[model samples]
Target: MTRSAPRSQAAELELPGLVRDRVREGRAKAAATRARRHAEAEIAEESPVARVLVDVPLAHLDRPFDYAVPVAMAADARPGVRVKVRFAGQDVDGFLLARTTQTTHQGRLQPLRRVVSAEPVLSPKIADLAAEVAERYAGTRADVLRLAVPPRHATTEKEPSPPAGPAEPWTVSVAASAWAGHDPAEAYLHHLADGGSPRAVWQAAAGSVWPLLLAHAVAATAASGRGALVVVPDGKDVARLDAALRQVLGEGRHVALTADAGPARRYRDFLAVSRGAVKVAVGTRAAAFAPVHDLGLVALWDDGDDALAEPRAPYPHAREVLLLRAEREGAAALVGGFARTVEADHLVRAGWAHQIRPTRALARERLTVAIAGASDFDLERDPFARVSRVPREAHETIRAGVATGPVLLQTPRRGYAAALACETCRAPARCGACRGPLHLTGATTPPECGWCGRVEEAWTCAACGGRGLRAPVLGDARTAEELGRIFPGVPVVTSSGERVRASVPDRPAIVVATPGAEPVAERGYAAVLLLDTWLLLGRPDLRTDEEALRRWSNAVGLVRPGGRALAVGDPALPALQALLRWDQPGFARREAEARAEAHLPPASRLATITGEAGAVDDALTLLALPAGGEVLGPVPHEGGRDSEEWRAVVRAPRAHATALSSALGELQRVRSARKLDPVRVQVDPPSL
Candidate 1:
């Protein structure tokens, strides 16, 4: 027994030595592996740390972060290429902003997980532009990057389709344009041709060939061995500018970069611009950011169109982006439209741009305008129309004008009926399920929610418990139906919503359409009836008058030179007067003056803070408002009783715009830190 005990003790001692040996061996192997990893990292030390703006999309994490470049991935992790990294414990994609040896981050930087692409999707100029835009609009850099660079399509990058030549050759002379004689216009063109960035804000007579004028300017820029970019509002304007640019720059000089061109085609065109294949770019709003090389001129037509305001976050208007690009790139800018808005007028007023006016004689020669007053119509000519909504003068003008060509009737609304309201108390009817405002798409169809698409058959108004509904404002369909009954033999064609006709044959027809949906007549419309003018101007919006004038002029501009337009409203309003006398600039200047007096936009900067009532109130309390800034709300956001949402408006003088923006941005940063309820922040919203 004693001998066995000695052996057990010896065995136990040997077990401890064996365990220590195994532990030492494991430690040695781990140290060797770490040493090899350190050696590899040292080899990659030559590559700078990449400052990547990860696609986290959270407003709080919008800034750039430092990432260590590995030797294997350093070649492909160049600035502007998409890279994947471990962020918040998950691998995610990001855009490399810059590569630098120095970083401000205090923590140990994580290695870039992998390189996603080496295509340089973002350019240095675009990075700078996006940053400036983010600062200007109080948006995140990541948001703007999402807009500046499209998603990468591997197939599109691998192989591109053969470029197609223009269907016909284009060779229009710039000097033969309608505005050749205007000294300011001539000087602007000469400046572009001389490689100078002279800004011009041109106002053209409505019926004049304005697209041709723009094309001439673009051609002047292209003539100096530089590129030009022209951004319009929609596909129609894109087509017009595309056609005009083709006429001026010839085949293959420009590429249209609209999303409607399909992702592959758009990406191809973008690549073409990056490759210096095209010197001119024409498209919708997104084209304002087209990567045209050595951009000499940036022009936007009809900047007031709502389509010019991007629907995505950061929500930049094309005009603002173009303005910034022109400043940053030293590119000339042309901000012109049929009707001017306060923003454009502010540019001219501030002397940032010069006003380009056509000669009075030329304007008179090109535009013919008339007014149909409410009380001046002849009752004897057509009693039915006079007694009804349509005036006798409208009937007479349509009858006489149809002999020459088609007639356009512009209504304010688009549906079969105006939004339904309680017949008794005049309160707007709403859907029971979604609280969306109820609208009638047809006379017999049940009332449906415009937002939720819910049909509300058993709906009653909250106010007065009324069941009957009435349309306070007339709509295009109802107006068309009424007009069809009035003009029995005339072919009545309705154009609005999904069935918007781009152009009508030059024949006798009554074209009833909503605002922004007027069909172009081949030769020209014989006459235009600006119906429901009161509804247009009576809206409680800041840009109501401006929108009215823009719409009225756009419709009237489609009329033939000798034809007339009869507006069915008071003729004394400055907007109507502007149309009657072709005084858009004068009207815009006056509108700006009025807005300045009222402390509205253009003269002052405005921002809206909207969210849950408590959250909005708390945020406003934390705001560090600049001097001369006024806070004007906490009101119900939806203008309804029992509403939980609220809104606050901050107005600051033009001189304090920068301070105001900075303060708002700081407040947003603090809100993010506190993790407060989300609130939407918008600067200079098109509508108040």
Candidate 2:
């Protein structure tokens, strides 16, 4: 048949239509390839072009939108560059993640309104770490992205700050090499030199020197010819550390980043780091994501600090942000705290981080500290918690400490945030649910329970019918008032919310403040007073033991070496005992063991799924996963407090956490394919 084919001269006259169609098909394929390459090159040439994936804060949507970049600004217009763009006919600040040759839009592409000045605000490494954090926390990428950048510049029309020149590179070294044997200051310095940055926890006992302790870490890291980032709890800490670091690194080698700086100044520091002018950065939570170059180490002074917890859209924890970044960038992480948080303990036990703990033997020999009424709450307790009452011994200690200098009093509540009510009606004279106290500060206001959305008619104490009720639990103001009575002549100043900071006291004074508001002892307090030890140690949260221990340690840490601090609880209650002996590492070890045995979250894994019942059901159907996984409530209840819809929760091993999360994410994509509902997904939710 092949040989005879040559004889088909007549058959060689093919149909004109078929021949033309073949030619057109080949030309179309060639044109399609040319179009794709052209689009990629055009985007590469102009705009801060990136397939920006942002979290709009909607419960049900998770995706990225492609945006074009202006050519002249493409140099600094790379991934993690915060940019201004129009979306849904409105302009918003978005982090430019990465440029892409693909797009999901058929509509005309929009160019970035302007680059947010590529001052390297969001480093490439941090950007990747942010995405990973979102994944580990079962949170949205946009959620973490939002965290990586500060509040978007207010206007689409704005001028960029003037540029700053880069500063010379810096180096680090310890002040006292002999200090390393058993003391934490030395231990931490040695830890840094050992390439221990990926993860390390520093647990120092009370009386353990920390400013000097952290200084050692900073110096060691700097000496390695790399960068270091340190984060403290608040302004007082920033001020204190700024002075300490300058002593070693000299002026202008480091920058202090706190919100206290005026807007222009803050922007200047932000740009300084962006321009590599500042090799070392220190600040509160926001500085954890600093964009320093060749970062070799990261440190957090206190891990349990609420200040480290960002309350914005993603709500990422700073301790965690640094932990994740350290691993990803191969940098050392030293979480230095007077007391250890259970979460840090978990990392240590799991071999994810080293427990840089000071020996109890060394701690015990330094200060003879003890909880006076260690076994009895009556010795030191708060009325609000219904624990043992505050004791006479603890009171006496404060009386004694105050004579030498300032007596630091730690309260459990601050601001108007703490309210009181009538115990008989189980309601305090409040503004019904707002929990605002129904006080006659001005006129005779009817007493009501701030909670329950109910107002009492002439709500007088049923027990006494006296329409007046004082705070059931005293706030910092009330505490200050009482301390005034307890020590009539001593000046009583408050250090609670609003009146948060305390100046260094030169004479005998009583500084009654809430936890977290305690000011740095400008001249160092002669003695510290712990009012409600049990109340803090026995709260209802999962991290209660951990939190209580931290607060106590921080309070005790303010004391001068020869000065003393006392906790009023059964010092035998492991946590209090740890306090008496100043044993944070041991306490952390015990807490870590308890957590792992419980198989509860942080030990295992958890995820929250919420959305339309149909979509949730679809996801559940796909997850016939292994036994390590468990799905909790899609039990169908009235959500939104009063809405008619339903929601559910799914918890599983962390190993399969992403699969379950993706199933949920894909369900979202599928649901979005048609319509969406008011569903929310939170992985490793900080709180339910």
Residue pairs with backbone overlap in model 1: none
Index of the highest-TM-score prediction:
1
Which residue ranges in model 1 land beyond 4 Å of their true spot? 1-45, 106-108, 160-173, 180-183, 376-388, 419-473
Best by lDDT: 1
Cα RMSDs of all predictions?
6.8, 11.9
| Model 2: worst 10 consecutive residues (lDDT sum) | 439-448
Q: lDDT tens string, model 2, 1-688?
A: 4455453443544547787677678789999988755544465543333766554654245556787765645676777667778877788777776786666788878776667656446666777787676655545667776555555344311444333233334333334442443444454565566555546777765555576666666767777667888989888888878877776666677777877885656666666666676668898888887777778888898878777777664556788788877877888888878888777877777788766665656565445566765344332344443332345666787788788888787877664325556654546554534645553211244444444546556555545455545555555665676568878898988887677784556578888778887876666677787765656765656678878878878887777656777665555688888877777777877887787686656666666666567757765665454457777778564445554545676776657666765565555455545565435555555544
lDDT values, one for every candidate: 0.81, 0.67
Q: Global CA lDDT of candidate 1, please?
A: 0.81
Per-residue lDDT of candidate 1, residues 1-688 (tens digit): 3444586456556677878677678889999999867744652666568989988656667788898887777788888889898999999989998888887889777888778877777888988898777777777878887777777777787664344344332223344454654447877777888788999887766565667788888878876778899998889777777777777667777888888888888888887776676778888887787888899999988889999987777777889999999999999999888788889988988999998876777667666666766566555664323323777778898888777789999988888887778878878888888888888888689989988999887888887888898776667888788788888888888888898888899999999998888888877788888887877888898888999999888888787766777888777888888888888989999999999999988889898898999889988999999999999987998788588888999989989988887787777778887888888888888887
